[model samples]
Target chain A: MHNIKIVLIQTFHPGNIGAAARAMKNMGLSNLVLVNPVDFPSDEATSRAGQATDVLENATVVSSLEEAVQDCQLVIGTSARDRTITLPALTSQQCGEKLVAEQQSGKVAVIFGRERMGLHNSDLKQCHFQLNIDANPEYPVLNISQAIQIVCYEVFKAGQKQYEPQIEAYPLNDDLNRFYDHLESSLTGSGFIKPSHPGQAIEHLRALFKRARPTSKELQILRGMLSSFDKE
Target chain B: MHNIKIVLIQTFHPGNIGAAARAMKNMGLSNLVLVNPVDFPSDEATSRAGQATDVLENATVVSSLEEAVQDCQLVIGTSARDRTITLPALTSQQCGEKLVAEQQSGKVAVIFGRERMGLHNSDLKQCHFQLNIDANPEYPVLNISQAIQIVCYEVFKAGQKQYEPQIEAYPLNDDLNRFYDHLESSLTGSGFIKPSHPGQAIEHLRALFKRARPTSKELQILRGMLSSFDKE
Candidate 1:
């Protein structure tokens, strides 16, 4: 995966910062730079981060946007509103492709503004591309952490699949079955399947996608897919 | 754009229908077939669709998948899982090419399974191919409407302005036919396909390949598919 930096400018909520850290970690993106975030070292941020405290602790706290994105080749500003400025705009996929392309040669940073008002006009002016997620117009604004999660998730998916060691790569059928057992147990607790027909339902799901037998990359997608549902 | 039919199978959410319609419309795709939508003409759907009500009203609502995709020459079931079955798999891009190619000469359909459990194994068994959209490891799954948007968006992007008009006269259909014949013969020669069924099967293959009639450059790469499979 490319080393992508995320700069959150003037974040007000500590819980959101922690949640953003968790989102970044989930998507395999760890480089986070906070510009004047309120309550950075608070318990709220740490607790919300869950298992991603390392990201917050290692986060580089800066006082200015220029400092945060100084060394970055690609700068992207996330905004839901159309600022009507003539910035070189790109969709998330375009941004993803562009970032992947640049990763071959240099580093990239995606800069996000504050939660409520988003980036000021001056903040967006310094970016190379603007990413506007096509969200519901009525409720176009997304929670800061939710937005981070979505972006990081896409970045992770764009990376090439990982290869396992040769011995582990060719696992026995029993191992496969054991993995499914673990998956079922985890899913059942999450209410993915009914208790009375756990085997039947899981077997059906297993049969639905048995061809690829799922690499770890695919397993992650399944886990993420199920976890995203946990939000509602 | 290939005249491909989109099947929303057993969709329970009307808002998703609206969003799916908007997605299709934005991509310049018109054909939509809904199988057993839980609610139609709902305020939520119309409100959510915003400007895509025409797509929703014109959508064919059928009671069964057999009716929805009956006239199509190729069928694709979208899944986030790698079902245990040994089905031929295609990425969204490959599927987009195939659908567009088929659209030139015949009909095609892309089927999205039910929201909760997705397509039953039996439902997917009917498809010639399964296309998976890579997503986050934990939440690799996408909302029904979001999936529709992404797939259609890719198809639209693939068909965008990539051609430059030449001063040469329009090539005769026979010239195109000769190229198609050469492609078929080369694909067959490379042993990319099993030669058990000769007549209609080959015709199906021909129609399928023709649907996304390749450019001169793409035609050259199609031969690579044959050689790569040979190595595999």
Candidate 2:
């Protein structure tokens, strides 16, 4: 069994929770923890889960975030896009990759916020990093369950791709995703991203780096480069 | 003005067709050709296209694949990661980058097979090369519009990135997938796939590479290794 747990904090929809369970099942992940879900074991959720009822039945439901992730060695919070907080962040893939690496050492948990508002700054502070998916700015919001599905899928994929006998080169996609988010965030914070228009400049930046698909190590160097920007 | 004209062949879902149009629009490509789409001027498609209806309204609806690419200098077919035929293939990004490059010299057309069966072998034969997206083998299929979005998005990203003239050495995700696929195929052909299990061997292979996250040059070497098996 994998040493990773997926936690949804204050989830608003029963169907989404169910769908999240289904997504987890499809990815071979069983440890699901829900924090104050709107409904549980509902007919809508069970039916939407299709064959994933087992996941829902076995899921641990808690009332608060602290209780859900207390034992986790690594905790990651999932957000829609940009948040007001200056917290360290990782893309969904990064979060997944990190979880896998951490799994080798200890248990890891990924935290997802509510549908409408997402994770609160207070909630994010509890996490090792915030998770963001690279989505179109015009429509930055993703359905809570869909976001969960993508993140869970990436994590599951990253975990499977972990073959130890052969030392494959480069960071996994999850690690690369993390580095990209850090680069983007650091760049934006450093004012390298000019406001030429509403979203065009950022779009151009994304276009540039996404093509590069920087490795985690490369990303670490980019972060170091950005950190040195403060000295200049 | 990129040389790629994305042709949706007999797309059944109007919303998907519309989404495909939106995807192409976001990627900065305008040339779209539809072949016998189930519904056009559809409220769902138009509504889904959001601001991209102009692409749909201006899209050329052709009678056949031949008519769609007759005047093109290069034709590429898109398929998910599955080997139902024996054909030389490129990963989606490779096809996208090559097509973009080819467009600098001549016209290129990318044909998307029907949603259900994908490009028929005969349809695939019409193309200069077949392109496959690296997705989870169990659910390797992607929605037609999602497929279009990813491919066109990569193409647009590549075009913008190429202009920067940077020495960034990052390998693309697609390149990694091709090498992985080649290894999987060879393993299966060699009877390394576990008996009475449909996906055990391939799943293990996917897990192995997913962790490694091979670089472009490294992937090339791995593919070269697989080619040696073919020669034997």
Q: Give the number of the best model, judged by TM-score.
A: 2
Q: Clash pairs of candidate 2? A: A93-A174, A160-B207, A161-B207, A161-B211
Tens digits of per-residue lDDT for model 2, B23-100? 776557778999888787689888767567788888998888998899899998887645567567887658768877
- The 10-residue segment with the lowest total lDDT in model 1 chain B: B165-174
After superposition on all C-alphas, the RMSD of every candidate to the true structure, in Å, is 18.4, 18.6
Backbone clashes, candidate 1 = 21
* Model 1 C-alpha lDDT per residue in residues A32-145, reported as the tens digit of each score: 999999778899899767667888899999999998888888899998788868577777667767776687677788888897789888998779889875454444555556
Off by over 4 Å in 1: A1-73, A78-85, A88-94, A101-123, A130-157, A161-232, B161-232
Task: Tell me the tens digit of each residue's lDDT in model 2 across A85-198.
Answer: 334557666776777776775567888888778888767655656676655445555556656666665666577666443232334434544554664554455454434543
TM-scores across all candidates? 0.52, 0.54
Positional deviation of residue A195's Cα in model 1 after best superposition, in angstroms: 62
TM-score of 2: 0.54
